[model samples]
Every structure is written in C-alpha cells, then in structure tokens.
Target: MQAVPNAFSVLSHPSLDHSGGGRASSEVPRPATLFESAELLKGGKIVGIMHNGSLYRLQATKLGKLILTK
Candidate 1:
C-alpha cells in the first residue's frame, strides 16, 4: 500500500499535455440519439458494435424498443 500525496504531488506523473485540458483520447462519447441516423443504420433496426474482435448487436424491436446481444 502507498500513502496518499498532497495536492502539490498531483503533477508528479507524466502527462500528454492535451490542449483540451485533460480530456482522454480513448474516451468514447456520443449523443443519446446517436443511432437515430438512417444512413448509418441503413434503414434497418440493427447495428453492430465491434469490440476486441467481437460483434455486439443492437436491434430496434417491432414494439419500438431496443435489444442488445453479444
């Protein structure tokens, strides 16, 4: 275990010096209506989310609902 450092010790670690002032490049963010685009969805109710060589399926149901499966 390690002891906690004071506020002055915060910058002791290396940093990328992002001009965005600490926004992570790897952070994936999107708007709530991201899948609302007809072109991306291709006029279908399904879309695939690829992660680590795996495909996740997102489907819009006939009841106007959503379902996700791996």
Candidate 2:
C-alpha cells in the first residue's frame, strides 16, 4: 500500500523576503498534498489521529459531514 503523507499543506500567499524588499518569486513552493476522506477512513466510519501525544477522533456523520474531536 502507498504511505500516507504526515502533513498536508494549505494554499499560502507568496513568501516575503524581509531583506530583499519584495516577494520571493523565484522560490516556488511544493504543491499541497491532497487526501480523500474515504482513503483516510479506509471504508470505515471513524479513525483516530495522534497529534502531539494526544488522540483525536475523526468521525463521519450520517448527514455526510465530518467532525473532529479531541
């Protein structure tokens, strides 16, 4: 099976070069990783996530929405 990415990136504005006086146009950032909820749950209704030594639960509701709780 393919390994899942540990982190996902969100779209961010162009980075600013503090000393360069303009946006760092030459430094292209890596594209964000995307994952489908079905892939994450693996055909299950719920999944557990461990973050910073704490447990988080991701649940899919009957209404086709998702919720995360600590």
Candidate 3:
C-alpha cells in the first residue's frame, strides 16, 4: 500500500451535472487519503489506531464492513 501524506489534505476531482448537462463541469473536493481497508488491516481483521494518546479499535465485520470505536 502507498503512504498518504496529510490525510486531511484536499484534492479536486471532476464533478457531473453541475449545469444540468450530465457531464463533468465542476470540481469536487476530497480527502487525499483514500485507503483500501485491506491495506490498513494488513491482512488481518483488526488493527489498533492511536490518536491523541488514546487507543481505538478498527475492526472488520463478518459482513465485510468496518467499525471503529474508542
């Protein structure tokens, strides 16, 4: 997986239907960090995320979803 610099950084992407033409006519802002769950999980179903001196749980559910909790 690739490293993301400044997870909060904003980037722009093409937007559609801004002028009701059904075409990309505008730009949309998105976070720079767009990561696949498997990359963060690192081949596992769970991983610990640390923030502000606190530990959090990041787990993959059996239904193929993610849940993060403090």
Clash tally, candidates in order: 0, 0, 0
The runs of at least 3 residues in candidate 1 whose Cα sits more than 4 Å from the true structure, single-residue gaps closed, are 1-40
Q: Which residue pairs come into collision in candidate 3? A: none
lDDT of candidate model 2 versus the reference: 0.73
lDDT of 1: 0.58
Q: What is the lDDT of candidate 3?
A: 0.72
lDDT of 1 by residue, 1-70 (tens): 2333442233322254344556434554332222243554677999998989999998878887878899
lDDT of 1 at 4: 38
Q: Choose 1 or 3, whichever is better by lDDT.
A: 3
Candidate 3: C-alpha RMSD to true structure equals 8.7
Candidate 3 residue 1 Cα shift, in angstroms, is 5.8
Instruction: Give the RMSD in angstroms, all C-alphas superposed, for model 1.
Output: 15.5
Global lDDT scores for all candidate models = 0.58, 0.73, 0.72
lDDT of 2 by residue, 1-70 (tens): 3545553333334443454555544666655656788989999999999999999999999998999999
Model 3 Cα lDDT, one tens digit per residue, 1-70: 6665554342322342346665543465444557878989999999999999999999999999899999
The better candidate by lDDT, 1 or 2, is 2
- CA RMSD of each candidate after superposition: 15.5, 7.1, 8.7
TM-score of every model? 0.42, 0.59, 0.56
Candidate 2 C-alpha RMSD relative to the actual structure: 7.1
Stretches of model 2 off by over 4 angstroms after superposition: 1-28
